[model samples]
Target: MSINGQPEKVENIYLTTLNEILDSIAPQNDLELSLNSILKILAKDLHFQRAFLAIMDPKSEKLKLSITHSPAKIDHVTYSPGKGVVGRVYETGQAVVIPRMSENTDFLNKAFGRSDEELKSLSFICVPIKKGNSKEDHNVLGTISVDSPILPMDNLLEHKQFLEVVAALISNQVSRLQEEMALQAQMLSQGPLLGGQEVPPPANFVATSKSIKQVLRQARQVGPSRATALLRGESGTGKELLAEAIHACSPRRDKPLVKLNCAALPAELVESELFGHQKGAFTGAYQNKRGLFEVANNGTLFLDEIGELSLDAQAKVLRAIQEKEIQRVGSEHPITVDVRLICATHQPLEKLLKEGRFREDLFYRVNVFPIFIPALRERREDILPLAEQFLEIFSKEYDKNIKRISSPAIDLFTQYHWPGNVRELKNCLERAVLICEEEVIRTYHLPPTLQTAESTATDTSLSFGEAVAKFEQELLVDSLKKARGNMLQAARDLRVSYRIVNYKVKKYNIDVKKYTGAKKNK
Candidate 1:
């Protein structure tokens, strides 16, 4: 039924036997269950001693035994790349079939604890399970191996070929399950905040700096309370992310989280947007609509750019906080709300209050629990960690294979003063991932803002050893150019022995044909 299609019979019995084995596994979706059933079938119908499937862990990059069925129930087994037969298959993407396990020197039988007598009578078959369809575009996920009894007239090559077909049929199932299980396992391990240690940052938040960790610690401490929190930071400093973190770990996490940007709306519509308006209340108020406060009842409300709210809207918000009620525009009826307020502003409220632009009563209410988020340049240590996190995210989003940032690019990242903060850094990395076509993001691939005199310069002498090597290589090349690629004359011109010149030429791996004007080799 497969592309390997109906194999011609070596004899009557073997042909029927191979067909039964192939028919038993029909590409089921439940990978572990299918593997368990395949092991039972191989043990019963084919007299196979043991069978196991090893999958590569994406995080650790180590091969771990994922599924096995035998007398000893093993939870997990790890093998370094190119350690034994199974490891060899995973590394080289090649099949290995041995007549006797005892004769193979690399067979470490340490995981299963097989006896010497059992090893002497058993054969081994290991084959790689790759992802892509073609040989040039595939990644070897892991290996499938089995132990068979060393009986008379048993062809190991036939068994190896059969196992290879089975591996190809189930490669997709293996990749999906491994990633899901890894993510679930991580979520379960990061339980609740314990002791007085640094609180874990929520998803989409990266806080490796001491300044940012302090902000998270305060957020965790005040999240459960019903107090109003005022987040202070510069523009693009991720104040919204901090507000979401507080809401995610709070008691009202399951309820709706309503967000509004005060500066984004027009000044005249600020009140109607926050507390709603009745039908025909204003020029465009066609019908009655529920405001953000009603939607955020028994939940949290994130007001970004809160400093930009008009004075009339500020007084109404203060009344909502003090009395737990709001009146829609053009309506005197009071509607109660039970919302936990979280306000963020990149501007200083003290300056606004001094200028009579913000209400003093509302400022005191929201500023009860204050947390100031630092700018990206203030926490320079988090540059690379945050950049790498963004690199991985955008690589998957754009379906690009850009792997890592080069050394020169990393130097530019840490040295640049991020006037636009974390949001700007995220955009820069996303652009880099989109434009980068290689396995690594070089300095030339970064944004123009990051392309400084240092990064874009063509100086190869960045170190003492590098400068010496550059000087020495240049001297040797000049001597060769003058001597027409003749080693003996080049050594005489440079006042060195021919043997020393020969060693330096090979050390630099220089080709002399261009310098010789396409002359014959000496």
Candidate 2:
């Protein structure tokens, strides 16, 4: 039977796979069972004698087998990107059809223990499983190989095409499963909170700022309660990250962390997308859809950019929050959703509330635990560390050898007003990495805005090193003042350690202790 010609069977399998994937998207799945079944189905339907899935090592560009089964071998086996026929196929992104293995010089006989005399009788088909660019980059995710006793290679093209299609399917499911499993594993590792309602914290969260520390403390304090949280910040100040941290520390972490960007979805579809719709609910509503609230039942619903929601959608969202129930567009039955709400927005909600734009009641409901993320300019101490983080991130991202920022470049970054905040800084570093030809990013690699400021400095001959020291002094003084002479608080505010802040205070010769008069209470 020709695998490609079985259109009805293939269609059924595809539909079944899609449904399974969609169901797996929800949090109520046993990931291991789902993955095991997915692999089994793919292997069976593809008629492969042996099938395996591997996850690509991001740094090494090598495939390490994650799951597999063979009649001869019990489980998956390890293979590098250039090892055997499987590796060669994955590395080259081309199908290898070896009718006679002994005749093929490219064939590596490590998979089969048979000698050249015994291998000459076998035929094999190896294909690479990859996404996005299936050609050229050979960003090989994994590979699938099928072998049989010496039989004439029949319809090699058709078999190769079928293998490629199956490879794409496997890639999609495997990537999704990996992400879900990783997230779930993290959630499970975090111990339960005091109350049954609080979620745990995400492991990747890093905080050096007192404001962030206090925010986390507050979140932990009230996370077990049913209070709504509002995260206020500039873009890239990690509002979403804070939200995730809150969710991880809450009781709802076991369920879904449903996210909705109010500004991203169209206004016309906002209501439907958030509240979902029943069949024939509107013009194109042919199927019943579950909204974010329902999807996030017994969990958290993170509404990002909440200030961007239209008035109508806002009213609907408010009702949903207040009543703990949502009415689908065409369905009268109100579905109860036990979800903790977390919202974030760059817009000033108080001003919007005063202007009658944001609903007062809704604002009150979500503002129970409001936390503000200080901009990069406000927290000057975080600049260097954040820059270092970005340098590491983008260096690995762009595969560049850049290790550090020069004194001049660091000065330019420190002096520039980061109006766009942390998000903009990351973008600048990413672009710099792409264009920088040297081992380090210099002032010239920075954006023109930053470069212009350094160029126009009054004391250019002071040396970039001296200029940087002066800037650091000014920044330290400003931060100390902002913290009202509380050195620990100031250091925390700057995302720097107490020692560093104290050292800077001594270096600048600022009598911070003297400034700690009556203003220390605030």
TM-score of every candidate relative to the true structure: 0.52, 0.49
lDDT of candidate 2 at residue 368, scale 0 to 100: 54
Predicted candidate 1: what Cα RMSD to the true structure? Answer: 27.1
**Each candidate: what lDDT?**
0.79, 0.70
Checking candidate 1 for backbone clashes, the offending pairs are none
lDDT (Cα, tens digit) per residue for candidate 1, span 197-258: 87888887888999999999878766766667889999999888889888988889999889
How far is 337's C-alpha from truth in model 1 (Å)?
A: 0.7
Error of 1 at 133 (Å): 80
Candidate 2, residues 1-522, lDDT tens digits: the string is 345675455446555645654454232234456555555665565454444555665434556566555433323345677667777776777777877777877775553354666576666777777764456645566676665455545655556666677666556445544443343344344554444533333464445555555566666655555567788888888888888887876777787899999999899998888999999988999999998889888889999999999888889888888788998889999998888889999998867876778875576567655777777777777788778888888888888988677655777787888888888888899989999986668667888877776433456678888978987876676556556688998898779899998888888788886556624211
Angstrom error of the Cα, residue 219, model 1: value is 0.7
lDDT of 1: 0.79
